[model samples]
Target: MFPSKDAPLKIGAFCSIAGQVRFMCSGQHPTDSATSFPIYSRLLKQPEPVANGGKPAGITVGNDVWIGNGAMILPGVEIGDGAVVGAGAVVTKNVPPYAVVGGSPARLIRYRFSEDVILQLLAIQWWRWDDEKIKREAAALTGPIETFIERHSVAGTATK
Candidate 1:
């Protein structure tokens, strides 16, 4: 129901893209007294178009991210790279890189890593590393950050 492989499209890791990810609006409705009644009726009768109670926008997911089962990513939301959205999270805003977010409104619990370490990892761009190289470094990948850095630090650089 989407473009074929020949077309250029972006996909992320472990995400279940059921509906229109690019142009999905959780569809929020205003709560003013004048508008609320009609919206409430519409919501009771039919809820799909009014997912976020009728806001309109699209969602953008970056690479290497995992969106858990039954998660509802709302419109105009941009999920950054290496982020993890827990199951049943109703994301209503943009998620930063490597963030682990959950809950209805989706508050930021914590970053996946320290800011400096995250920056280093981003600069390393290890996601682009070949499978074999990654496999060789699998132990280090699962090891402490300092150990990984010490072992995999740039050539000719002192181990700090």
Candidate 2:
């Protein structure tokens, strides 16, 4: 949850958040407390106490991420770049960059590519490209990885 104005939820460029995807942003209620009712009064009368207390950290989604339909991304989870969240997955933790995650609480299925490839892609960060650049590299975007890399790799940057 982004309680602080400074730490707003960051969703990077080229993200695909499919229909019905849920983001649980705030978790201020204490489970051990007798009842959750008191927090509501606190919220209504004095906002500062509830705002500062026990709230979950903000969620961050990096560039080129794909969150599938019906997936639930919980509070404080940082979904990394190029990661894929499968349909119906309940993501409760941080997703590593370029990792494919699926299932309840979202366990890692596999990396989208090998470590070398991932490193290369991370270095490239093609999602940051301008519209013209992306359009120019349309073929590479849809083609095989080898070709994509070959065409776009330029001194460790993915730009023309």
Candidate 3:
């Protein structure tokens, strides 16, 4: 459960979170044989190492993203801005900006925007818009997503 503003915070942003989001360091696991063993407890206790080294990495979720319910986002994974992770997805890798990924060991289904457009949207950082403004546009915000994107997407955009 989320805490009240007055309480000491453990979980940040319980409400729909947006903008360059990243999970805590505790979520990743190691894939290499040196660090990996058949033992369950040791594996559970040790955070997985990144491919490059032993240092821990965080899961990063970018702006305007929707991570579906019950998705287990692993450590060191980065979910790019505007991407959507389907419900119950178990993410294991870095997702590109504007991608839509799902399934076990989540894979990229498609990019949500063209390269230029994605870059523009990233710069816009619309998720940082004030809460009131977002509420005012709620209908449009949740409307036919493609249409909404068409109207609000950064300049020089095409459909996904």
Best by lDDT: 2
Give the per-residue lDDT digits (tens) of candidate 3, residues 49-116. Answer: 34434433455566666877767666556667778887767777877877988889788888876676
Tens digits of per-residue lDDT for model 2, 1-160: 2334523577999999999987766544655556655464366643324343444556889999999999988767899999999999998889999999999978999999878777778888898889999999888888899888776665744333
Candidate 2 at 116: error in angstroms? 0.4
lDDT for model 2: 0.78
> What Cα-based lDDT does every candidate model obtain?
0.64, 0.78, 0.60
> Whose lDDT is higher: candidate 1's or candidate 3's?
1
- Candidate maximizing TM-score: 2
Predicted structure 3: lDDT: 0.60
Task: Tell me each candidate's RMSD, in Å, in order.
Answer: 7.6, 4.3, 7.4
Ranking of predictions according to lDDT: 2, 1, 3
Stretches off by above 4 angstroms in model 3 are: 1-24, 27-55, 139-160
Model 1, TM vs. native: 0.62
